[model samples]
Target: MWHLITAPILLPMFTALLIMLPPIHYSPNRRRWVSMVSSAIQLVLVVLLLLQVQQQGQLHYAIGNWQAPFGIILVADTLSVVLVCLTSFLALGAICYGSAGEDEKGSFFHPLFQFQVMGINGAFLTGDLFNLFVFFEVLLIASYALLIHAGGKNKTKAAVHYVVLNLTGSAIFLIALAVLYGTTGTLNIADMAQKVAQLPASDLMLVKSGALMLMIVFALKAAVLPLQFWLPATYASASAPVAALFAVMTKIGVYALLRVYTTIFGSEAGALSGIAADWLLPAGLATIALGAIGVMASQDFRKLVANLVLLSVGTLVSLVALQTQQAAAAALYYTVHSTLVTAALFLIADLIANQRGKAADRLVSGRKVVQPVLLGMMFMVGALSVAGLPPLSGFVGKVMLLQSVTDPDNRLWLWSLVLLSSLVVIVGLSRAGSTLFWRISGSDTVAETAKPLQVFAVCWLLLASPLLVIFAGPLTELSLQAAAQLYDTNTAVQLILGQEVTP
Candidate 1:
């Protein structure tokens, strides 16, 4: 059962190798079938692994039969399992949707997609910081290839900026890792967490600085405000399925932040105290405000989805800053909701644009509503969900988050800012919603019929999202347990405490 964690990480790579064989490469249709079959199998493996972890608790598998501190370990705790499931679901969805399009048949597409999944699963499962960094590179490199896969002028331009920015972030990450290893003398995350508290004040400060640098790197990846300029542009220029895949990529950053901050640094009471909550809370609020404004101002529907992605990051960041179990749980819930919603919206954007072009006879009329009734319904649900309206997954997360901030007595203004930002997000989402779906031209003749597979994939995911709201209680509980595992090293300590604990 424990080995199931490794299956999700290995199956894709194995399948990739099989697909690259001569016979498989000869037929494009066969290649597509092979990729789809592989993805479907991987998805089932992920779901089964998730169930195993949920039922039996944390699953640990050491690579090459070596123990921790001396060898690499793969951990499938609730948090990692949840992310694994999400990556599989989104990857499968994107592959399904993309398969229905012409570009999906490109020679490199299937391989890169599988490699991306491998990277994501590896990142989630790895218990070593260095291994995580390696997986990060793997994921980003695949993304770089996919982003420019279309080879258009727009994609090329956006890819350049994306690569340069991420490379800089990677440099900072490397420097931080060097400093951390220099101070702690171990690359294993569990080992580092144990030793981090024992370091001298100066060394601890260095580690904190290193951690902050890492946060900046991830913030850039996650598209947190002030570092989010490149995301909208790059995502807008990429193909829809590619953009949908990028949605899961941002959550990887969020996952790292949650794992590192709570599990490693937050364990050190002194270190956590030095970085006061006030500092992060305000910045998070500012990110939320900026993201809302970005959405409100954007004219392009694709760009609007990009801005909303940023807003989701802001929400998660704020919850992390709060640093409470409830808050972390809220962040977790929102993370799940945001990923699904963003993916759904991107799919809808593709459908709408494709339909509009057909309806307008390929005239490039801007923002025309081809199927007003269907467009109106989806837009209403999607926009309202993004805006955190009631009876949706977003609303549940927000309400929980709002209730978790205990400093209202002393920081009324901060709470006010949070509320104000929520209102601003509502306004921004509403404005975009009305303009893109409701107020746009209502010409049915020009609307082209979307591919059944693409429509089915999008609608299936969108429909699944409301289930998050329905099952909020169980999901929130899972998140809370995961957050507990994150913030308390006692869990890890107990797991290996009786065994060999030495590095």
Candidate 2:
């Protein structure tokens, strides 16, 4: 039962080790099966862990048999569980999509994919700042390999820029961690949260500077405004499944920001006093505006997805900036919705691009349209969902976000920006949708031959979109509870304080 708490992290790591063994390494087919089975097992473990955490409240595990303040800890609170589940689910989807063709099922792809998931889960569950840095390295290295797997000149160029930017960010992160460790004499997050407020003003200032520097690192990862230039170029050049996987990667940055700000810095009265709640609101608005403008101006479907990714980040950051419980809850819900819809959109783009290429071949050789109706319907559903139409998960999230921040008079400016951004997203999606599915020139005799498994996986996700909305009540409640866990750390402090004083 206790091991279930660590299963999310352990499962993928164990799977990676197994796949790397000599026997599995010898057979590509066996390796693919091993990868799929391992990811399926990981998905199940994540579900079981979520159920256990729901029943038990919070779960913690000590590494190397040492207790907190003395050794490493992995905490499985609601926020961590939500993120773990999201990562595992996305990994499973990407694995399924990657298993289809010869290029996708190559020997090198699955191991890196497994390692990426392990890194994401480890980062979410880790209770030490240094451990988080280690996990980030694991994830980034895998991503670099996956991004350049196609081995084109463009992908190579993009991967180099991506690697350099992320490495620079990693260096900044290490420096901040060193400053933090020197100031607090501890690396455990929970322990640092406890001591942050008691530090002298000078030391506290140093800590805040470190916090701000760490924020910049995460901002680069999250693709927030000025730091977001690399994302469009890099993601646009990656393969579709790889791009979809990268969607979940940005959430790691948002997760870190929410965790560090609310749990570590927000707990410090002086620090909270120094930074006003609405301080980031204007910057978030600026990000949203920039992303919207970029999307409208972009011509490629891949670049459009990149811009949409930025827009989602801006939306989440703006909600976080609002700093209300309701706003936090809305942000949580929106993040989940955005992750799913964006991934689906990328997969749909892949299908569209593949079909277009096939159509071009058919035109050159004069053949029939290959599964036009199926492609058309998939396109319509994905486009509308991304555009935030009603009866879809996107609509539910957008409505909640709008409802959460209804300050009629003074917030008119904010509402206008939100509305304008939504409209821009609609236009961007519509143009891409029309061009990809409807307006593309093709023959009527083309044969539809996409892998049945891939089509089934895509359909499963499409069906799940509405189901997410249908189950939105319970999921929303869970998100609200998770948000409470993040914003209300005083409960743990009170529990600790009520215990007998120890030397």
Runs with alpha carbons beyond 4 Å of true place in candidate 1: 269-279, 358-370, 409-418, 437-447, 496-503
The positional error of residue 286 in candidate 2, measured at the CA in angstroms, is 1.6
lDDT of 1 by residue, 264-312 (tens): 6674535544253555566667777787777767767787788788877
Residue 213 lDDT, candidate 1, scale 0-100: 79
Distance from true position, residue 268, model 1, in Å?
A: 3.2
TM for candidate 1 is: 0.92
Deviation (Å) of 173 in candidate 1: 1.1
How many clashes does each candidate structure show, in the order listed? 4, 7
List the pairs of residues colliding in candidate 1: 358-446, 359-446, 359-447, 360-446
lDDT of each: 0.76, 0.76
What is the alpha-carbon lDDT for the whole of candidate 2? 0.76
